[model samples]
Target: MTNVLVLGANGKIAKLATAQLLANPDNHLTLFLRNSKRLANAASDRVKVVEGDAASEADLKAVMADADIVYANLAGSIEAEAKAVVAAMDASGLKRLIWISTLGIYDEVPGNFGKWNHQMLDGGYLETYGAAAKTIEDSDLDYTIIRPAWLSNNDEVAYETTQKGEAFKGTEVSRKSIAALVAKLVADPSQAIHESLGVNKPNTDGDKPAWY
Candidate 1:
C-alpha cells in the first residue's frame, strides 16, 4: 500500500487530491491540517487526521513517519515552510515530494502576461514564493514543484504542463486539474522528479486569466 501524507489537507486542492487517492482502496492517507476538525467528516479506516502547523518541524516529522509520498499544499511564509518540510523529509528518509507554488515566480510567463503577473504579485508574495521554489530546487530530496496558473473553480480536469525554463502557457487552469496532476504524481512519484512544471488549461491563453 502506498502511504500518502497530505499537508494542508483542508485546502481545496488538497481535499480534491485526497479524494483521488482514496479512490484507490490500497492507498492509506495521513492528512495534516491546522484544524483537524475540518476534516473530521472524512475520517475513516483508511484516513488518519492530524492537527498541526506544517511549518513546525516537530509537527511535520510526526506526520512524515512511514509516508511514501508527501504532498504539501500550503501557502504563507512559503520559503520557511518549505525549508522545514525539506528538513523533516530528509530526517525521515522520505524522498518523494509534490509542492505547489505559483506561476511567474521565475518570470516564466512571457510578455504582457509576465508584466501583469509581477504588477499584481511583486511584493512579499512573490519574494516568498520564489524563495520557496529555490528551497525545493536546492534540496536533495526528489521533488516535483508544481507552479499553477491563476486557479479557477472550474471542475474540468484538462490541463498541460511546461517544464522549468519553458514559457508558462495559458492564463488560468481549474483547481480540479491541479488536483488531478497531484494525484497522478502521487501514483508515480518518479514521473516529474527533480522537475518544476507550470500547469494551465489548454486553449485558455490570453493576456490575462479569463477570470479577469
Candidate 2:
C-alpha cells in the first residue's frame, strides 16, 4: 500500500486528487490543511485529517511520518511554504514530491501570450511562484514541479505537457486534468523526478486564458 501525504488538502485540485487516490483501495491518505473543518466528511477508515499550517515544520513533521509520497497543492506565498516542505521532507528522509505551481513562473509562455500573462499578474505572482520552483529545484528531493496553465472546471482530462525550458503551450486546462496527472505521478513517483513540466489542454491555445 502506498502512503500518500497531501498538503493543502482543501484545495480544489487536491480534493479531486484525493478522490482519485481513494478510488484505489490500496492507497492510504493523510490530509494536512490549515482548516480541517472544511472537509470534516473526508475522514474515513483509510484517511486521516490533520489541521496545521504547511509552513510549520512541526506540523509537517508530525504528519510526514511513514508517508511514501508528498503532493502539495498550495497558493499565496509558495516560496516560504516550499521551503518548509523541503525541510520537513529532508527531516523525514522522504524524497518524492509533487508540487503545483502556475504557468509563466519561468516565462515559458512565448510572444504575446507571455507578455499578457506578465501584464495581468503584474510580476508579483510570478516572483513568488518562481521562488517556490527554485526552492524545489535546489533541494535534494526527487521532485516534479507542475506548472499548469489557466485552469477550468471543464471536468475533462485532455491535456499535454512541456518539459522545462520548452515554450508553454495552450492557455487553459481542466482541473480534472491536473488532478489526473497528480494521481498518476503519486502512483509512480519516479516518472518525472527532478523535472518541471507545463500542463495545458491540447488545441486550447489563445492570447489569454479562455475565461478572461
Q: Where is model 2 more than 4 Å wrong at Cα? A: none
* lDDT of model 2, residue 52: 93
RMSD of 2: 0.8
Per-model TM-score on C-alpha atoms: 0.98, 0.98
Cα displacement (angstroms), candidate 1, residue 90, comes to 0.8
Estimate, for each residue in 1-212, the C-alpha lDDT of model 1 and write its tens digit.
99999998999999988988899888999999989989998888999999999889889999898899999999876888999999999999999999999998888899888889999999889889999989999999899999999999997899999999899999899899999999898778779999999999999878888778
Could you tell me how far off, in angstroms, the CA of residue 8 lies in candidate 1 after the best superposition?
Answer: 0.6
Q: How many residue pairs clash in each candidate at the backbone level?
A: 0, 0
- The 10-residue segment of model 1 with minimum total lDDT is 203-212
